[model samples]
Target chain A: MQAQLIALDWGTSSLRAYKLGPAGAVLEQRSLACGIMHLPIEPRDIAGIYCTNGFELAFDTACGDWLDAQPGLPVIACGMVGSAQGWSEAAYRNTPVDVASLGQALHCVRSLRGVDVHIVPGVIEQVGLPNVMRGEETQVVGVLQGLGTQVLIGLPGSHSKWVEVIEGRITHFDTFMTGELFAVLSKHSILGRTQQPCDQFQAEAFDRGVQVALSKDGQRGVLSTLFSARTLGLTAELSPDQQPDYLSGLLIGHELAGLPDHARHKPIILVGAAPLCARYQRALALCGFAHVSLAQEATERGLWQLAVAAGLTQPVTEA
Target chain B: MQAQLIALDWGTSSLRAYKLGPAGAVLEQRSLACGIMHLPIEPRDIAGIYCTNGFELAFDTACGDWLDAQPGLPVIACGMVGSAQGWSEAAYRNTPVDVASLGQALHCVRSLRGVDVHIVPGVIEQVGLPNVMRGEETQVVGVLQGLGTQVLIGLPGSHSKWVEVIEGRITHFDTFMTGELFAVLSKHSILGRTQQPCDQFQAEAFDRGVQVALSKDGQRGVLSTLFSARTLGLTAELSPDQQPDYLSGLLIGHELAGLPDHARHKPIILVGAAPLCARYQRALALCGFAHVSLAQEATERGLWQLAVAAGLTQPVTEA
Candidate 1:
């Protein structure tokens, strides 16, 4: 099958390119280290033009070969690659946007290779606390096809995002520093001092942490409960090996606890790395969340849908 | 006035020696950089004995001159100096302890000069979640006199402690890693990337942070609210200089929000650096906490009381 679109998930640390056949089928894929933050800096000739820009260098390295194979392939990219510091700034679109609205708003930046790359605009909510996200909005669009009218989509990563979708439109969302906080605390704070790395999963310790986050003590909030991570070790209640997972569960539990009460009633969809999504699944179950499911290949499918909606590509026809 | 006792506030990063005269009045004082974590390493002759021990070197450096000037003066020390990692291990005393009990239970470590340094044992609470404190216990003891039967004392610092005292006995207490979290987040996390140092305090931003913590949105918990430190900046709601204070107020607000409901009705006392205490004072006021006040010279005063109670030093007669 001939490729219909080239979808790129270009985030802060990694870039993943997908060659989607008709109907956004995965035909070929490539992973590169050159996200916007880590783009190649060496100058090189591209399309008979001398180029030194990191963005152009990264762009060629990521999909230049695929583009050469089929020069007319429509290119669409998402994530921090379109931030203010990215290849080209894609101004954030306000909330209540879906594939149709955001697809129509793709910011195009022509590459030195003479290929126009359509960058998806991120979503922002300003109702109360200003919440923003670039990449997760695509995943939300990807997974909305078969979900209920009201759904909560959780994209867990360095910065976990919980997006609320009503019908097919993105309404509101929240960003949690849970993953980053856990990383920073485990790597730099006193909590890391006693944490022993382990090969086996400390399920009991993790469950205990989730329970603590839901217990009366957790009502005091994470700032107060965070000390338990260290004190529990001092009291010989948590072994050094169990401390890391315990801290993980505690943070994930707190993140889940922050979800709106209505979220418990909505069908929840999670999209992220398998291990992290599994952790969230466990924590959500512990938190009494009943309707939870995981979604796969969200970014490519969302990018495909947006590409089609924007007339960059056509939907697959019946065989 | 002649020196009656030498009191040392020995903590993790710094040590302070105070000479108290009649009625526990300040006679002389010295500050040393050598805390347990940063003790001096050079070999030196002390009291006719060659010593290479870091603890002995730090001990001599802290107040060897004061001891030489008044060889018979009694000495008492509090804080991390009593931990297992300190110069000598002082077993933690369980909670509901008063000055009399802790005073009588001083753990004595004999120095190279043949002088015994009395170390105050820290307090540990075993109820529900375990909580521990070393130096702050002495401060709690110092500020207990003449207060109401039941009062809450807050020691704001790297690890802020909130103690619930009843009739001069520490009944229950909690520790919040607020100050340390703020430091690590500001220095190491993405939150610090946009923060600009300003000589002037951003009171408005700080107050807004406190309000956000107390607001309905804050009910979601701090792990969720922490993202606002960046989002508020992205939206131009907070300037670079205001970001730091805003984060400070936010964390402090969440810490205060964790306080039990009864804390609002009980008298509250804060002890620490005047500037930090003032920040907490302002936040506490914003949180609707009415009966809040500050205490001064808590560590030194508490050390004096404990020394007198332990019979290490005689009580001064009124002049």
Candidate 2:
């Protein structure tokens, strides 16, 4: 089947692309190590080297480069690639937004090669403190379509997001730096300097961390709780290899604990990479959340929905 | 007066030496950039280079070296110099320990040059989660002698310690990796990547962070709230340079919020370097803490008490 549309999910350290059929189904997919921050070439020329041999390119370059290899097609892109630092800035749409509204808010740009490019706007909440998301909004849109309204969605990644979809609109959301914290702490902190080989997750240690995080009644926050990861190792309560999982549990557990009280009773739609999803699923179960379900290909699905809503692609018929 | 004893406060990055008279007054002091981790010489011969002209010495060699230049006198050391990776291991004393008890627990060793050396023991809390402190015990001991019983003391640093001193004994304490977290997040995390020239503290941004941290009711935790540092920048609510102080205030505010209820009602003794103590003092005041006082020369004063307690130096006669 000839490609009808192209979808891209470009983030800090990765670029994922999907070629879709006329029915909005993914026909072929490609992933690259190139993200916005690590782009070897300048941002202006990124579209030129999209499919080139070496430097990984972002959406505009990838789309322009693909069109250079073949012909033009409608392209939908999301993630950090749409930020002020990306190919073009797609200003964030304020929250309490419906999926259809997000479709109208897509930032459209004509590539130098004349390809139709639409960058989905991220969501921002400015009520108490400012919170923003770029690529995750698309995933949340996908979740909203599948799970209907009044559902809680947990998208776990570098910056995990917990969204509240009330009656088909994103009323509230929060971002947790869980994954990022885990990564930095593992590599740079004193707790990470110990010569422990952490190759895989240890369930026992992770559970202990979850328990400790839950036990905190706001009196002792994560700052104090994190030290226990080191102390547990020093006291022989946790092994070296278990430290990573323990740290992960501590962060994930804290994220789960921070969820609004109403979100806990309902089944949360888990999205993102399979491994992270599984970890969140386990953590949610441990936190008394029993009906958690996974949503695969959320980014692609959301991009397709946005493409259709924006009238860039035809809607898929229900199978 | 000629030096009657020598006291060393050796930690991870620097070494400080003080020469004391019979009355325990510091007659002279020297500081070197050498520490346990960066020793140019082997661990065993550190004593011999104490009074040497170069950084090519560890604690033991420096001591031996100092003795070589003059007659034998008792030497005392505290901090990471006695860590497992230091000159010799001074086992951590269990909590509920008296100020004099730490002196008795000091690890005594003789250098190859036959000079007597005493290393003060750190305190360990093994009740719920294991926590160990190497250098802060000396400061806690000093605070006990100066503040009397039933006082709450905060020794802020890389690993900030909040200790409960009752009747000249260190009963319980908590360690917050506030400074370490600030350093790591500023240098390595995405929240730190924003081009904020954070040389000096920005009071407005710092106050905002403290307010946000205090507003968290254990629901969102620090893991989630930390991202506000980035979002506040992205939304133009905070400038780039304000980020560092904002982050500092957030961590310090969370640390203050986590203090035990009893500790909040009393005058908290703030101990550490001037700038960090000032930051903590401001944060404390923002958190509704009044009557905050500073303790200067805490490490040095603490070492003197331990020295006299261990019979390494003559007891000071109160004027």
- Give me the candidate number with maximum lDDT: 1
lDDT of 1 at B295: 97
Candidate 1 lDDT over A35-66, as tens digits, reads 88898989999999999999898888888888
Over B1-319, each residue of candidate 2 has an lDDT whose tens digit, in order, gives 6666888888888888887776778877878777877775433334344444223345444454456655567788888878887778898889888877888888976655566668898889988777889888888766666564588889898888998888877788898989899988898999878947766669998888888999943238888899999998998888888988898888998888889878877768988889989888898998888778988777777888888887777785444
Residues B106-161 of candidate 1 have per-residue lDDT tens digits of 99999999999999999999999899999999998899888899999999998999
Q: Which digits, one per residue and each the tens of the lDDT, describe model 2 over residues A176-287?
A: 9899888888899998976376566688888877878888432388888889888888888887888888888888888888887788777689998898888888888888
Give the CA lDDT, 0 to 100, for residue B193 in model 2: 85
- Root-mean-square deviation of candidate 2: 3.4
Residue-level lDDT for B52 in candidate 2: 42
Local distance difference test, each candidate:
0.92, 0.80
Question: Which CAPRI quality tier does the interface of model 1 achieve?
Answer: high
CAPRI tier of model 2? medium
User: Where in model 2 is the C-alpha error above 4 Å?
Assistant: A40-72, A217-219, A316-319, B42-56, B60-70, B217-219, B316-319
Best by DockQ: 1
DockQ of each: 0.89, 0.71
